[model samples]
Target: MTDPALSELTPEQAQMAARVRRMMLIAGLTTGLGIAAVFVAIGYRLFRSEGSAPAADVTATLPRGARIVSTGIAGDRLLVTLEVGGATEIRAFDARSLKPAGRLRFAAEP
Candidate 1:
């Protein structure tokens, strides 16, 4: 209480110092909160995805040069029809094992 000279400052200087301190505190808090929010969001996504991907049951393979026209699935089977050099090839596949089960086709006439 007795250090009067050090405590004394011009009114304008005192006001400016108060404003600068407040600005610094507000800026620091804004930066800190922004960084904390980003970390929280990233952590949430990381923790939540552990159980998300489903196990798929089957796949299909076609000869490389075939151009697939359409594909569909019925019950446990996959039906695919494709064309190559003006010939249409159709095949059904077992959905679980992905092996060819049957074939049906109608070729384009020359």
Candidate 2:
């Protein structure tokens, strides 16, 4: 008996081969999409996560060597103390307006 491997295929056999080729193409595309999805997930995990500290919507950073020593509220008054250059300065502000009223400066040490 002759082998069938190298023989010319019939019409039905050719159609089956075409169908198999289409199925393999679809499978290849689906696998490629899945791999891309995995890569996206890994990228999101590696580069898009929250860092150590939460982000601030607004920030006001005082200059170096200046420290906010205290804060107080009296009725409609706001008081804040800034200690800088070995001196403590007291500042008064209008609480409602959030504007400076007056400040008393203390002499700094030599």
Candidate 3:
């Protein structure tokens, strides 16, 4: 079937329309490729852990009196809850190296 829109356009107008369509297609493909590259980079970074230690020695890194209550992973950080004396402490560490980043201690109830 003939396209009514194409039949209505002059020869010059048809050429311009074709050029615009081609430009839009190129632009869309470029945008898609850019987005795909970003996602691939993110995936590579997330999964790349070669040459690093198989496991982090978390227990050895804890304080002498601290006892691990729970453990979890958050983004790039490791979350470890410890019971130190009578206080509940949340220790945050670098997930890859197990290096201590910071700690949060809950105050004892009155």
Candidate 4:
């Protein structure tokens, strides 16, 4: 038996073929758009800068006889508890820049 030509197809078959082609075209377009969106998102993530790069090494100077008691991180700040002489102190530094944010000192009442 010979294969039927496009012109020889029944009306219903031609309509079904046309509908299939349209569906395929829509599916291809949606797939292409999804791939393009993924690529764009990846590119944006790679190229966008959130903030300045952190320093490689940071050095913090302390007063004479000052010793570190403990260290911790709170949100974007670095907290360091220190014992200086006979008093206790807490210092906060920016986690990214390593710059001093604030300081709190505790001393006994006279």
Top-TM-score structure, candidate number:
4
| Preferred candidate (TM-score higher): 2 or 4 | 4
RMSD vs true structure, all candidates: 8.7, 14.9, 6.9, 4.6
Residue-level lDDT for 21 in candidate 1: 99
Clashes of each: 0, 0, 0, 0
Question: Candidate 2 lDDT, tens digit per residue, 11-33?
Answer: 99999999999999999999999
Candidate 4 lDDT over 1-61, as tens digits, reads 6656644988899899999999999999999999999999999988895767756598899
After TM-score superposition, the amount by which residue 56's alpha carbon in candidate 4 deviates from its true location, in angstroms, is 3.4
lDDT-sorted candidate list, best first: 4, 3, 1, 2
Of the pair 2 and 4, which is ahead by lDDT? 4
As for lDDT, the candidate ahead, 1 or 2, is 1
Clashes of 3: 0
Using lDDT, give the best candidate's number. 4
The Cα local distance difference test for each model comes to 0.84, 0.80, 0.87, 0.93
- In model 1, the worst 10-residue window by lDDT is 50-59
- What TM-scores do the predictions have? 0.46, 0.41, 0.49, 0.56
Model 4 clashing residue pairs (backbone)? none
What is the lDDT for 36 in model 1? 100
Off by over 4 Å in 1: 1-3, 51-110
